[model samples]
Target: IFCSQYMSWTRNYGVQGTIFPAPNFNPVADAQMLAGALQGFGCDKDTLVAVLTQRSTAQRLTIAEAYQSVLGRDLIGDLREKLSDHFKDVMVGLMYPPPSYDAHELWHAMKGAGTEENCLIDILASRTNGEIFQMREAYYLQYGSNLQEDIYSETSGHFRDTLMNLVQGTREEGYTDPAMAAQDAMVLWEACQQKTGEHKTMLQMILCNKSYQQLWLVFQEFQNISGQDIVDAINECYDGYFQELLVAIVLCVRDKPAYFAYRLYSAIHDFGFHNKTVIRILIARSEIDLMTIRKRYKERYGKSLFHDIKNFASGHYEKALLAICAGDAEDY
Candidate 1:
């Protein structure tokens, strides 16, 4: 699912991740402490945060299993009763495996009356097809529902078609071709440049079908021939979620860390701070290129992501994020 591009990304930025499995861990001990924390009159929310956030997701999953075996209680269900809001979100997020967490978010986005279109766009537009496929499997296991079916029922028309194709989990992979890149660029140009009306399928096909390596080359060729970026052209012609999805694909292909940094920045800069989005990316990317994303955030926004988190978020939620924001890369 991932490519050598990500290795180059990690190398260029020197950002690996922020979290790892704790040394000399004891899941039974964790389960016991969690039981002790929850047994008191006033729940030890602080204890809950400490126990949950300090461990890796894999370790947390082990704790959940051991908690079940030792106390015969679901650690997550107990936490569900004990915590709320963003605090609960980050903690619960730590418990879910990455693919399942993504699946849960996708389910949340579509299960209710209205869709969180941005969440939908951010996830679908950003994930590799293999990640989406694993998420689909997790969604089915978690909810007994096919992701594609749910999406089909929840959405309609061109946007629906785009998402359906995206979820197919079959995109062009392997080597980048310079000659084919120029040809594909011309195809994309025709797709968006027609005077009568834009051919969205052409754009969707190119974005959904090509490998990121190939797409990067194609985007370079696209700018060379068109004299403007594809993103600018999309903004000039398209509207709403369609535009957002396409732009996300372009940003993701161009620089994934930058795309996430944009999301992180939006989550923080807006009124009231989009805490769910903030927590989602922060926790989700903690083990990936969050350090890279943080660097990009600073480069793009002229401020540190950690400084903004300290300023806007508080208590255990802030602490957990700050700890993860510590950078996965050793010596960051």
Candidate 2:
């Protein structure tokens, strides 16, 4: 139902971004200002938001360095000390690099007895080969252990296999060729349509191995031949999380912004506040295409994401999120 409706829709992935590196950036000066803001009784949260949200992560890193060198204090540590509750989540999130933050999410996902398999699917399915590679590096560097090893131990069955393939970053790249695209489309059609029993091995190979650009072409070709969206067929054939995960991959390939828009919607409206989800999506996409996402969220949900956060949140947490959501929607 969902994937079919979005099949014809496409979003420009990199056309818009919300956050940018602050102009005339003086990390030392900003660091001193932040220190001053935090020194007194009630923190000047407005100044904190103004300085932190407007600056890019690299700028934040420099500010952290300056804060350390100048005040001989950890910037994130002080922010943690000064801020509490939901707001602190946002501010502390700003201190981490994207992949480093992603590694943190993965660690949390698999930390306890149970696991959030959907989190595994979200990161592995949506990210690029280079991004996956970088996240693996960052995960190892940050956590002092291998991501693949963790996934192997934490998850089982074909689901683990599916995630491992995405983590492997083995998708074929380069411009799409009509000949290969046609062949791949036929392979998928036969594997899903003509055949009966679970062909997940064949399915995973085709879905994970092809470039997204080529897969889009194959999805079109599959529709032309079968008169059915591949995602619809997958839904009919498979059930449960694996089906949902495959659909997510297709949705991401078709329109990544829409995929994330759906994610943001679920995170917000899914039975109270899933703060973890909110923090990850906002922080990771803030510097990327959060503007596009905000626009899409308004179009789809008929409300402002900023307004939703405002209504559902309060205190410094709300202030911090509003700072992130209120960013200029212009190219840097």
Off by over 4 Å in 2: 1-14, 40-42, 193-198, 330-332
Which prediction has the highest lDDT against the true structure?
A: 1
Q: Candidate 1, TM-score vs. the true structure?
A: 0.91
Model 1 Cα lDDT, one tens digit per residue, 1-332: 13345445656775566665666689999999989988856677777767776677888999999999988889889888877778878888889998999999989989876988787788888887778889999999999999999989988767787888888888878768999999988987887777233467777888888999999999999999899898998888778787888898899989888999999888888756898788888888877778778889989999889889989999878887887787444332
lDDT of 1 at 306: 85
Candidate 2 collision pairs = 87-317
lDDT of 1 at 174: 78
Model 2 C-alpha lDDT versus the unseen true structure = 0.81
Top TM-score model: 1
Clash pairs, candidate 1, are 17-328, 18-327, 18-328
